[model samples]
Target: MAKIAFILLCHKDPDAIIKQAQSLTAVGDYMAIHFDASAPRAAFDRIRAALADNPNVTFAKKRIRCGWGEWSLVQATLHAVEAAAEAFPRATHFYMLSGDCMAIKSAEYAHEFLDRRDVDYIESFDYFQSDWIKTGWKKERLVYRHWFNERTQKRRFYATFELQKRLGLTREIPADLEVMIGSQWWCLRRRTIEWILDFCRQRPDVMRFFRTTWIPDETFFQTLVRHLVPEQEIESRTLTFLMFTDYGMPVAFYNDHYDLLLSQDFLFARKISPEARELKRRLGVLYAAEGARFRISNEGRSLHRFLAEKGRIGRRFAPRFWETESSLGRERELLIVVCKKWHVAKRLVQRVRQMTDIPCIDYLFNEESCALPDLGGIQSSVEKRHRHRRALVRMLFDYYESDRLLVCLDPSNLDLIEDFCRDRAVTRLLEVECQVSDVFLVGHAMRVGLAGDRTPRETLNRLLPTIRNDMVHESDRIRDAQFDNHLRLREIDPPETNARAIAAFLGVPGDTAETLAETDHLFAD
Candidate 1:
């Protein structure tokens, strides 16, 4: 009989952790848990007491005070792995999981799946090839030295690091190391796990180097396994389902996500909070039914297909919102205003709203400038962060299938317009110009604390080159572009004239007099 050992890294919610652990318990299965050292002793004691009667359960003696983006997470996991190997030497496979993670499939099914596979199940991708990293700020984590203070759980930045990098300061990774990054969750054969342990013991220097890397937990094991295992022996599937938001934060699963969760064929789902008690109960029910070997229904298969297609479309096009095509059909015209300057965009939205009853939505990227909801929250797994803005615009287009659509592009965000046009052809493009000083003032205002003793005007002057660079890029990209409409903020006499011009561009009817008067007061400095 093949035996499996589970290594669980737990920090909070003792009851939930216990519940998840109990779900995976079976004869000949071993469980080794490492509770975070920072967590309350009482919580750890409670978990220990609950599992004390189980002969296969063991607690790691060496606990780490794990901090996010720190080496402690890796240390804790290693401790758990070591303990599991010691306690269950005969175990054939090791399944590494987090406290918040729950097994979606039954122990029997999971065992059957792994027992049939001779290869290790882990997700490993080249860091440079990953779309998410290429499209987001995660690349900085690889190139920069990020130091995390475990005591405070805060990132401490070195002011001179950027300068050092500019001056060709470099850190050399080992010649044999091929850096790989991916999901932290994995399942490995006992031999592979032991090999990893022995490799780490021999290469303490490699481990030490990883300690300085940002979020080493995500890359350390991934890089090691990819290097040690033969390419053909590795299965690139981590049987864990995780959803991330636009900001790279994990999306909290709720009861509403039950259908979607069920559609996934993964063995486990993660980051489930205690607040979603209903979802947990529902999952338990599904697990019981599936544990009995219940076949997926036709409806379930259809739903799965639908979800998979949606995911594919989302990755290629846009994030899915709950709104239907019929709901947005009432609007005859749709206007998308994209700008970095929130105040100006807000004013424009207000004027447009006053001018016409047709539904108008303003999407602003700068979080600090306005409270209006933006595309920043639409982080569907289908699209990378760099492609998120385009996905959002496409979603808007799908939702509001209006007769006419007007999109305004900010000079700084002209790249978005260019990408969007490339992906989906647009007949009309409108370019809006604002005073360089005004744009600089807004940028400076947002970075007040970082400016030290510099005045907003002085700071603007210093950042002029960067602003000019953006303008140059925008001009180059749009040089051959044909615009059906164009407006310069400073050139328009009376704010109403610009309002009327925008109304004409959007092909909507409105009382320009009232809109102009209202916007005049709004633009008054």
Candidate 2:
């Protein structure tokens, strides 16, 4: 039988690591873990104790503290790889993973999949220099020519300086040299690991590139493998699934869909806590499937037991499910038409009427709401802000509940509006800034008219780009508009109506506008 070694590199968080190990251990697979030196000593004790019973596991003899911008972490991981290689000398393949990652594949399936790949399946990508970056570099590299007369040369000089400053580099090198980045998590054939290590030993300067590169982990591996390994042997595509973490922030994996961990991706996703239980429960269906789908019993014993247990649990919860669904359907789909009092939100009611005659529930938040007849007090304010936010949350919840189309609008605050609804699974759109004003900061939050009819992936494809582009356009427009607003104020005696007038124009019902104007004395002078 071919041996497979699953290695986890970790810091602190023993509980989470152990939970992950327990799940992995249940499958009776070969596993090893390296707890980083910086992890609390208590955490190491816990980790050591947790895996002590597993014969396949081993704790490293050396540990090191890793700084964010340094190569220590990568080195530590490489060290773990060497150790695993020695221990499982005959092992066919190895998976380099993090403590935070969970296995979605059953041990058997995971092993078989790697066996089929027949090549190193570690997820890595080729780093190509963009044409723009390359085009500018040729003239900049002409240090001895002293031919700095051309505009492109000067531009290149300045651009290179700026990049050097950002990267904290003191020296300049020829730009013709190519660089690459590879994914940190990789599945490697044992031979590939031996070859890459040998190359690193032979070439010291190539290894030093890690000192200055922003993310050395990606680049070091890519550069080495590309230069040393035969091209056909290396796979450029990532065989495993992962959601990229947001830049500069760590610890949150938001709804990433990877095929391997799709079902139980987040089980060991974050540190254990009561607050995250709801998240776990939400993902439980996928969690059970992950294990059962991969368990490699010849008789399919584990799969049958898992499915039977899940079915029993499903039956008991069936009644509560329908009740919850009905309540959610009624509550989720909300119509929030954010306007000051008199402007587009109220007027756009006519447009909405054209779109669909679904007796829309309008929410008004602005300065001058009281003046409108029979004014329903929906003005956005500090006191009513929570109410408005809650309504927004409820509307999102409702949209998901109904799985039906819903729309809400916030003309001014698209960033905040996007924050509230990004995960709401709403078919969302952010209005371009050219269409709105900053004072109307609650950018409109209307459900896309066709959201309910599309699949989740389809909705995201339509909405994410529109929101991103709209935000960029709005930012540019705001910059231009700010300059125009400043110029207009300098030349004219503007009306002294304060926020109330702005509110009145915005379509807030009269009472809310009066309160806004009165509170700020916008009506004075």
Residues 152-244, candidate 2: write the lDDT tens digits: 356754566567557765544324335555567676777877887787687676555455444466656666666656778877754444432
Off by more than 4 A, model 1: 132-144, 149-155, 158-160, 163-168, 285-291, 294-525
lDDT to native, each model: 0.64, 0.46
Residue-level lDDT tens digits of model 1 in 1-525: 557788899898898877766656644578899999999999999999998888788888798888887888888988999998998888898888887777666666767878777998888888767763546446566666666553464333444446546876657676788888878889889989999999999998798788878778878988999999999989987877776654667756777656545545677788777788998987765543444452321132232232334223212434235322212233333344544454566676676666655445544333323222244567333233334554455555565554454444455454455444443233334344444565564454344322223223433344456445545555555644544343334333565665565555565545654354346544432
- lDDT, model 2: 0.46
RMSD for each of the candidates: 18.7, 20.5
